[model samples]
Target: MEQYDIAVIGAGPAGLFCAIHSIGPGIHVLLLEKNLQPGMKLRISGTGQCNITHDGDIRMFFPRYGAHGQFLRPALMSYTNQMLIRFFEERNLPMEITEGGKVFPVSHKAGDVCEVLIRECQHPGVDLRCGEPVHRVENTPLGFVLYTAGDTFSAKNLVIATGGASYPKTGSTGDGYRLAASLGHTITGIGPALTPLLIRNFPFADLAGMSFAGLPFSVWRENRKIFDGQGDILFTHTGLSGPGILDRSRDIRAGDEIQLSFAGPVQCDTFEREFQNIISRAPTRSIKTIIAGLGIPERLARQLPDLAGIPADSTGAHLTAAGRTILIGHLTACPLVVSSPGDLSVAMVTRGGVALGEVNVKTMESKLVPGLFFSGEVLDIDGDTGGFNLQAAFSTGFLAAQGISKRVGKRT
Candidate 1:
């Protein structure tokens, strides 16, 4: 029957960071977790590099959340990239900038960052728990009571830092969603984001183990343009993936066509001109060999002829003028039928959760209930790849903890 000023329902980025914000000399905060360790998912993020944050201006950070990004301005501003970097530096975990402004610890270990956060909870006011599964959250006359199999705890304020439903092995088992909804908060449609795309084409098999750079691709939702970006893309056994494809995976619906403008920044006419003139430089070469050098992956080079309704073996000398134009068009505009996105289990993050409007945007507290706050992937906001998800989790958790600090400290 331990009593505390604040009870946090997770030990991940949101819960732990939130506890850090609120925990001072007098504050008593309990951070709970079901896993044996905190930040198991963080340990594996960015292929184990753990992209800490982006190294860009604020506006560049916003669009990472897609449409819901607008809601994250306050928290992100309150704890910007510079602050995050400084926070790590203060703790002796210096960071460095990777490609696309993505930040990572100079040591390149996600566990090192997690270690600093875990060590931060060593302060007297913070009591962090692991391997504890909280069963229910009940509002008590005093404030809130959280029941776990091991013990029952009461708090003046509750922060649901329980994360999203991606990477179940990482321990985000949609616990926050259930907890928030139980307290009368409305959760939006939840789906996988920043995950890989699943295409049905078998020829895609040939492209497996291939990665491309500087290729542009477009995402569409029933004829309406959703997003487009030029970057590296890779083909896995499951489907198309990489930075450009994962960014689009959030809003992509079922049965959508993933139209790829392989020409990238080069306009269609310019590509067309480049295509026609390219063969002249290698007039004696096979058409497949000539187009293979058109700045695309070698696998795509051989496939373009088949896609253009011309035999791949056909040389530039064998093709008619119409064939040349058709080949150029197919090369510029390669279409991949995106039957579905990669499995949610394999997804990097979740798309939707507790609605932002239902929670106080300023405090991250539940509007329907006092002494209740939510953070991390449980929130409705979703960001694309490149460390935005972790940043969101860290921001909301810290913000909610600040609110709890003010309320609980005054009550005492």
Candidate 2:
């Protein structure tokens, strides 16, 4: 059986980074990948542009990961976004920050990012093998042992960077959860994050391609408001999408109500007053015409009156008080009930994984099992879109490498 100083599973961003950083004199590292090639999902990130990391102060990145933000503070602060940019730029790959502060390679090719990591893996002391799926792992007093279909390997330290169950075609099929569970680690409730929502009886099927920037929206469960924020929203044939919807998808569940405000941040009462004033001033004008004047898209404005059960030819003067209230409700708080979120196949990230309580945030090492570590999406850490997830993967991987290196030094 072959032996290694450290063995890292899954050759996505996390595994590759851990292996690359773990290389040192006499410290042999084995990087195992189930797929035929490495970085399969990384190559498709950001629609192939590869938003590597967000350009901003590292302090602002905490809230992007939702409730798990503080847990990632040590890793993120250790490997800041500027340090990540410099790591690539030093290797001759320049980066650029486009609109919305998303950082990407100058060439705008995700393959470029993968190529750099692949080349780095070619260094001595790092053995990268593709198409080798680890079926099981066992802990030994001496170290850890990994089993494949035809091979077995031993390592003094192990890092499970197998990622979470998202984009399964790239080899992320929740295998890490199983492996972690076998090792006595708790796997939290797993579900799709950063996915689109399917609305029940969607009304805007005809306006599928329409999108809004910084659209204000709120989520409600029963009568209680659970979430209220704004982001770019896209109207799909089945429901809603875009950054605004995807970022908050983790917090939403089936049957939750999504209330969209087409008229910015105007409240119900404010909008009702403004609507009444508009109607009083333009009694001769059509309701749809008056709605379009309030900055709503003409097509959507035209359909709003019909959705509110108002006649097409009705003028503001013909709109009764009740009819006015209905129109205001539609404009201010158009409610759409979620039927379901996009499944794991469509989700960009997984919400849950090995519970964070079982792992050390400062070093990415397992608290229950010494010399065992985890990183990336497999460790109950998923961030919002626009490079936050990728950054977390790299930061955690780097921290895991540091932890493994220190333990190996102590053993030697």
Candidate 3:
């Protein structure tokens, strides 16, 4: 058997970084990748711009990962975003932070970022084997043995960075989940996150290209409010998408009801008073024209009356008391029933993976299986869109490498 200090599966950002940091003059590292090329997903992140990480205070970054945010404290504190930025800058890879605080390569090419990682991982004593997939991993009494297509390899430590089940085309087909489960690790309920919602009987088919910035949205399940958020939302022929919906998709499930409020600056109560004043001032103006003054697009304003059971051509004075109440409700809460979540193949990230409780966030090692480590999307850590998930991947990978190095040194 080919013996090594550590064996890392998958060649995404996490695996590459782990191998680069774990291998040195006295250590031998093996990187096994199923795909023909490493960093396949990293090469296409952020639509090729590759949002590396968000440029912000480290204190504000952890909570974006939700409940598991606290779990990532040790790793994040060990390698802060500032350290990551400096690491890349020192390697001649300049980065720029957008107005929204997303950091991306100044070259505007995800391939460049992948190239740097690939080059660093190819250091002497690090064996990178592509087009090779490990079929099984066994924890023997002496160490761990990995069975691949052509041969078997053994290592004192193992790191699984197989990523999540999103974007299957990039080779992230949820293989790590099965591997961990086989080792008696608990796998959490997996679902799609950062994906669009498929609305049932969508009425805004004509408004497909229209988008609302800073749109206030809420989700209700069985008439109980579940989630509330605000972000940019885009209308699709089948449903809604954009930052607002994608960021909150994990909190939503099939058949949940969505409420979108287009009344940008007008409060429902204030609108009622202002609407009556408009009617008293201009009784002959069309109700459609009056509603258009509420700040929504004219086309959406024209359709508002239809939702309120009033004709589009009706004048302001034509609105009865009941019609006025209906209009106010419709304006405040436009409802859309969700049919389903976006397909996993299209989601930007996976919501769940190996149960967080089974892994030590400090070292990225398994609590049950000693010498077995995991990082990246294989764990039950998913963050909001805009460079958060990638940052977690790098930070966790760095911590896992540190853990593996210490363990291997002590064993030797």
In model 3, the Cα lDDT at residue 187 comes to 88
Computed on alpha carbons, the lDDT of every model, listed in order, comes to: 0.83, 0.93, 0.89
My TM-score estimates for the predictions, one after another, are 0.92, 0.99, 0.97
Q: What RMSD, rounded to one decimal, does every model reach?
A: 2.2, 0.8, 1.4
**CA error at residue 236 for candidate 3, angstroms:** 1.4
Which candidate, 2 or 3, has the higher TM-score? 2
- Sliding window of 10 residues with minimal summed lDDT for model 3: 259-268
> Per-residue alpha-carbon lDDT of model 2 for 1-412, expressed as tens digits?
9999999999999999999999999889999999999999999999999999999899999999999999999999988999999999999899999988999999999999999999999988998999999999999997899999889999999999999999999899999999999999999999999999999999999999999999999999998999897999999999999999999999999999999999889889988888889888889999889988988999998898999999756899999999988888888889899999999999999999999999998899999999999989998888998999999999999999998888888877
Across 42-64, the per-residue lDDT of candidate 3 in tens digits comes to 99999999999998888788878
Question: Which window of 10 residues has the lowest lDDT sum in candidate 2?
Answer: 403-412
After superposition, candidate 2 runs with Cα above 4 Å error: none
Question: By how many angstroms RMSD does model 1 differ from the true structure?
Answer: 2.2
For model 1, how does the per-residue alpha-carbon lDDT over 65-184 read when each residue is reduced to its tens digit? 888888888888878888998999999999999767889999999889899999999898888889988899888688888889879999888999888888988888898889888888
Residue 50 shift from truth in candidate 3, angstroms: 0.3
Predict model 2's lDDT versus the native. 0.93
